[model samples]
Target: MAHLPHGRKLNFAAGPSALPLDVLQKAQSEMLNFNGTGISVMEMSHRSADFTEILTQAINNLQDLLDIPSNYKVLFVQGGGTGQFAAVAMNLMRLKPNHSADYFVTGTWSQKAAKEAEKYGKVNYVLPHTKQFKGVPHVNHWNLDNDASYIYYCANETVHGVEFQEPPSHNPDIPIVADMSSNILSKELDISKYGVIYFGAQKNVGPAGVTVVIIREDLLGRAMPSTPAVLDYKILAANNSLYNTPPCYGIYMCGLVFEWLKTHGGIETTAEKSNLKSSALYDIIDNSNEFYHCAVDKEHRSRMNVTFRIGGSNGNENLEKKFLEEAQNLHMIQLKGHRSVGGIRASLYNAVPVEHALKLADFMKDFQRRFGEPEA
Candidate 1:
């Protein structure tokens, strides 16, 4: 097994995933005295001018990277994607008199979001729930509610390795809400297509603890009567995400990540790299002569999380175990799949280089050569 530079291993964890080395190094250097303030960002006050600058720059960089519209407000709030599941319901359920919303359940994450939304209003499943979420149901088959407050769906399902090929088609009058937690910066998106776009920073953004909400100007001030001040988009946007002291260090780290992406040729370049990396890995899985299998549909496969199995669909437990062990031995760590659906998941986020992906593909080929048998 070849060693990576600085003795670091390739990490493919789904969330809290790999960050740019340059960002980490920069953070390390600034750990003691950030911007000559004589205190670390973690130790600084949220209201301080220095921290304010960090927050502002992060918002600006992200806006530029995603081409966020001038009408949208970029807010940094506490709580991960799970919190937004409820928040989405709490805030948007009041948009219409019926107090209902349409949810397109694709996989684990979206299903969970829909379940949470049920607590606050009438939840309509646009597509019937299936035992196995292998692909997105056709838009034409969706049972959309014309009077629903908003349309909700996860941009990518991390655990199931399923992703939407594009935004779902819906009524022009109704707004769309997307939870882009796993694939936020991995590709370019049309910000104007949705009324609300929120994501946790842990995946392709920055780190955990900070969630970024990009909400259209019109969507504000619609929170339910029970909505907390902290969770209210109107309040957060009004305060510029400074409501009740935000996640200081997490926001700072996200700012650094945005800067790193900008210097590395922006979102378009990252999108191309993401496609190439996922395609190489998928090619290996597809051409593995039944030695490997990806259950996801060809069109809806996730670029960030590539989930597959060893020894075919049923999956040989022993071979799968051995593959993970050997891959770890080769300094490739966090290759294990999610607990709910056990197999192997290689999360090739923006930070994961194409070369590393190719290396993983090569390793997969060699593993099959050693362990696989010719089909009868």
Candidate 2:
């Protein structure tokens, strides 16, 4: 096994998940004196020249990685995805006097986003008749109001382990906004397709403090009078996300991650790595002969977080507990699913190495051999 700090265990927990070992090491090396400034990034002033350069380079690196349009302003704000849930509505509701927002509720996060938006304006579910968040259906089947302020959806549903296989069909005039908290930087994206893309840094980007918001030029200056300046896209963009003291340390660490990504061949290569890692576990599930079950519809399975239950009849909780306990004993920790829903969820973010996935897959195969009901 590759040596790790704290003799690190393979982390599979979703959000605040795994970061690249190299990134962590680099952070360690620089924690004491960031670029010869002799102060930890945490101690640096947000308004200082060194930090300004760091912020600028971070933005530049992100623009190059995501192909953010020149007309779009990338702002690093203080809140997480939940914060953007409100900010998206507050900023976009002013698009018209009769403003309304439509949300595609494919999973828990998007559902929460849609609910939070109701506080700012009228919110409608694009697929209210849907029974479950297993997968997305035909986008054309959605009852979309073309003149709506913004059509919102989560690019990846972290909880349900579903992802948009393709961008949803939408009216060209009405902008599409995405909460890409889990899937951002996982793969190449068409930046032009969305008027806005925002993600909390904890998942794939960096740590949890900073939220990156990419807003199209035209979407700015539309914040309602009651909108808090910190939450207003235009105001934050105008002040360069400096309306108040931003997450200095978070931004610095995230910048290091961006640099790591670039050095590791950008998002395309990183995504390839992610895809391979997920398949290592998924292939085991697929071949497990009713011993394992993936609740997500196959077509919509996420490349980041792989969720599954175990056993034949109704999955044996005893077996599940045994699996978790044994896996932890192997130093592969945090394999438990979210409390809201119970099952196993292995988040294979950009930083999780393929070797770790293989080790977990091997462990899973052994568990099934020992505990799985014998084949007929």
Candidate 3:
């Protein structure tokens, strides 16, 4: 309901996505003088009490939102999601020597994670895409190594628009590690199912620079000796994610975003809203039949990133281009698809209202009316 300064159009970029309006205003109002400290959050020292209080509240809010049990420790660290690829590998590889790790390759991000883990230990890759990245591979066919260290998976693939509606069930002894970079905090998930869950705040949380890691306490202190102190989870968790200089400003903004989530009725409410938005958009895609085709399988379509193409059989070269141009002219920005996949992608994050999705559906219908085959 609130409007941006000078009435700017809504934003729908994948990461560094739109934030709650009130949260932005609160941050702006406090930018010059935080809590009467007469200094910006950016200027405060990480060791100061003011900043410490901010960090504590932020972690508590995160724990509360995720319903993380006492067995799990919430960590706020730097290096974004990509950094965690190496961090998870370095820490978990401390398992007994000769143990291999299993990874389910759903999309580009998961593939990158598996590749990173191979540098440390034997990595068993499952469900690879030799042709083009599509839906998640059937988990029933996944070959599991009983002696593996752990299993890693990316719950949602932002680039390829693939998502796993349900978590994979694996051997109880083999821990599960997840990269929820694009869809963290957007839905309700059982925190106890995984040994480690890491996500970048830039998407669905707040801004770039900070990554949130929820790891079971038992998984700590297992880092390889060569692992750097800062990257080591044991050291960072011991110091409360301040082993060295932390991303103070980014963490503070994330705290504000957490507060916003609380006010919006927590993760369950947000998940319901997300489902509505995704369903509205996907319905339009489904009803279009041959007019618009989704590359990913129906069962594994992503709720956050709805990807579709205009031309199905005709293979019209400029159809996607026209869609982007017209959508932009109508003030629907950032609807262009990723360079890797040539089609339009609508990223509906937490901050995006259902009305935006409706507007998008309407536009897609009108666009189809113009370019699609005549209705029977």
Best by TM-score: 1
Report the lDDT tens digits of candidate 2 across residue range 1-376: 4555678999997989888888898899998998999999899988999999989999999998988889899999987999999899999976967779888999999989988999988887888565467888776668787768889999998887999877788888889999999888989899998899999999998988899999899999898899988898888888998889999888888888899999989998988988898889889999999798888888899998898888752567888889999988888988997777677889989888888888999999999999887888
TM-score of every model versus the real structure: 0.98, 0.97, 0.96
In candidate 1, stretches whose alpha carbon ends up further than 4 angstroms from where it belongs are: none
Name the 10 consecutive residues with the lowest summed lDDT in model 2. Answer: 310-319
User: Over 4 Å off in model 2, which ranges?
Assistant: 1-6
Give per-candidate clash totals: 0, 0, 0
The better-scoring model by TM-score among 1 and 2 is: 1
lDDT of 1 at 359: 85
Candidate 2: which pairs clash?
none
The deviation in Å at residue 355 for candidate 2 is 0.9
Better of 1 and 2 by lDDT: 1
